[model samples]
Target: MSQQKSDYIDEVDVDESWDEHPSRDELEETVENLEDSGFEVEVVEDAEAALAFLQDEIPAESSVMNGHSTTLEEIGFMEYLNEGDHDWENLYGKVFSIDDDQARADARREAQTADYFLGSANAIARTGALVAADLSGSRVGAYPFAAKHLLVVAGVNKVVEDVETARERLHEFAYPFENERAQDAYGVESYPAKELVYRQEGTEGRTTVVLVEETLGY
Candidate 1:
C-alpha cells in the first residue's frame, strides 16, 4: 500500500529560522560540546553508516525498546526491528503482541527500562543540549533516566545555534510533523504535552548520540 502524504507543513505556522542548517564548523563545535557534556558522540557519514553503527553497537540477544521516531523509521530501524533476523529480544514487539489492553499498557511501561532504548531528538544545540517532546509521556519518559542505555539518533540539520533555538525548532518543526503523524496513525490531534531538554549526561557511557551528516527527521 502507498503511504499517504502529510500536509503538516502547510497546516502549522512556523518560523523559517527554526529550519536553518548549521555549517561544517558549527557541526564540529556541536559535536565537541556534546562530547564535553558526557554524551558519546559519533558523527557518521550518512544514514547508511548510522544504521551500520547501530547494528554493530547493539549486541545480539539484548532487550531492545524504542519510542516512535521518524528518524528510526527513515533509517529503516523500525523495519529491521520488526522483521530482521536478529537475536535481540524486541520489547516493542512483545508489547504489541499482548491482546489484553491493560496488560499491554503495563508491558509498555516496563519496556522503558529495557537493556537499550533508542530514539531521536527534535533539535540539538551547539551549546550541547538536546530537545524533544511528545504528546504522551511514552517516548521522552525513558530518555531522562529510566533506560539502562540510551541511543539517540539525529541528523546534522537538527543542530542549531543554542538551547533557545533548539526549543524553537521543537515547536516549529517537530511538533507539526508529530501532530500530523498522530492524527494519521491514531485518528486524533496531538500536542507537545511532555517535553525534555537534555543538557548533559551525568552518567558516563550511559548515552550515545549518533549524528548523521545528512538532513533527517523533523
Candidate 2:
C-alpha cells in the first residue's frame, strides 16, 4: 500500500508555524517577483481549481510526466494522470509498465525530458525563489532545463520570508514529512542528496508556478 501523510505525521518533528498561509501582501509581492523572474504565475482558489487549471493549460496531445509530489497527489493529479480520460501521452505510465529493471530505469530517465514535466517545491520564498530537494536527482533534475516545460504546483503555506528561510523550511519542515513517507514507502530513510534553489527562469513560457490558496503539502 502507498504511504499517506497520516502514517507519518506523528513520527516527525516539524515547525507547525511553517504551515500557515501567507498574507495578501506577501502573495501579491511574491507573484509579482515570480513573474519578473520569468515564471508564468497562476494563483488558484483551491485544489479543485488547481486541477482544473492543469486540465485547461496542457494541450491534448502533449507528452506528460511528473515526479513524486505529495501536493500533486493531494490535488488528485496523480489519479487523473493514471486513470482520467485524457489525450496526452502518459509517459509515466509507459515507464512504469516496463518489467525489466534496466529498461524501466532508462525509461524513467528519458521521461524526465517529457513535453510537460510537473512537480512541487518544498518552499517558495516571498522574494520569489523556490527550493526543493530529493534523495536522488529524479525530481529536481528536470526543473532546470531538461524538460520542454516545467509546471510547479505549491500551496501558499510554503511561502517564506526569503531564500534563507525557504531553505530552512525545507530542512526543518518539509524534510521530516518526506523522510517519514520515504521510510514507510521504501523501508529506508531519505536524504536531501541533491538540492535546488530555483531563483529565476531564463526561458520564457517554459516554467509555470501554480500557487494554490490552501495548505496542501509539506
Candidate 3:
C-alpha cells in the first residue's frame, strides 16, 4: 500500500512558518533571481498545472528517471510515470525491476544520466538557491551534472528568506518530517547524509524549477 502526505503529516511536528506561502512580490523576485542564476523558471497555479507543464514539455520517447520525492507523489507524477499512457521510457521502473541488489544499484546509478531527472527540493531560498538532502546520494546525485536535464517541482512552502534560512528549514523543518516518514515507511531511521546547496546552473536549458502556488510537499 502507498502512503499519502495526509496519512502522516499530522503526526509530525514541524515549524508551520516554513510552510507559509510567500507574498506575490517575494515570489516574483525569487523567480527573477532563479532565472538570473541560469535556471528556467515557471510559476504554476497548482500541482495540476505543474503536471500539465511537464506533460507538454517532455518529448515523447525521452528517457525519464526520478528520485524518491513526496512532492512528486503529491503531484501524481510518480503514479503517472509508472502507470500513465505516456510515450517516454520510465527508467525508474526498469531499474527497480531487477531482483539482484547489486544489479539494481548499478542500474540506479546508470539511470541518473537519463534524459530527464525529476525530483523536489526541500527548501528554496528567495535568493534562488535550492537545498535538499538524502540518506544516500540517490535523490540528489542528478541535480549537479549527472543527468542531461533536471526538472525540480516544489511548492511555495519550501521557499525561505535566504540560504541560511533554507538550511535551517532543512534541518529544523524538513528533516524531522522526513525522518518520521522514513521510520514509518521503511522501518529505519533517515538523516541528511548527503546535502546539496544548488546555487546555479551553467547550462542554459539544463535545469528548470516549477514552483507551485499551493502547498503540497514538505
Q: Which residue pairs does candidate 1 place in steric collision?
A: none
lDDT of each: 0.87, 0.92, 0.91
Candidate 2 stretches with Cα past 4 Å from truth are 1-4
Q: Residue pairs in steric clash, candidate 3? A: none
Overall local distance difference test of candidate 2:
0.92
Model 1 lDDT, residue 87, Cα = 92
TM-score of each: 0.93, 0.97, 0.97
Off by over 4 Å in 1: 1-17
Best by lDDT: 2
Score candidate 1 by TM-score against the native: 0.93
Per-residue lDDT value at 99 in model 2: 100
lDDT of 1 by residue, 4-69 (tens): 113456766666556566888999899999999999999999878988898999999999999988
Candidate 3: deviation at residue 137, Å? 0.7
- What's the C-alpha lDDT at position 64 in model 2? 99
Measure candidate 3: CA RMSD: 1.0
Residue 20 in candidate 3, Cα distance off native in Å: 0.4
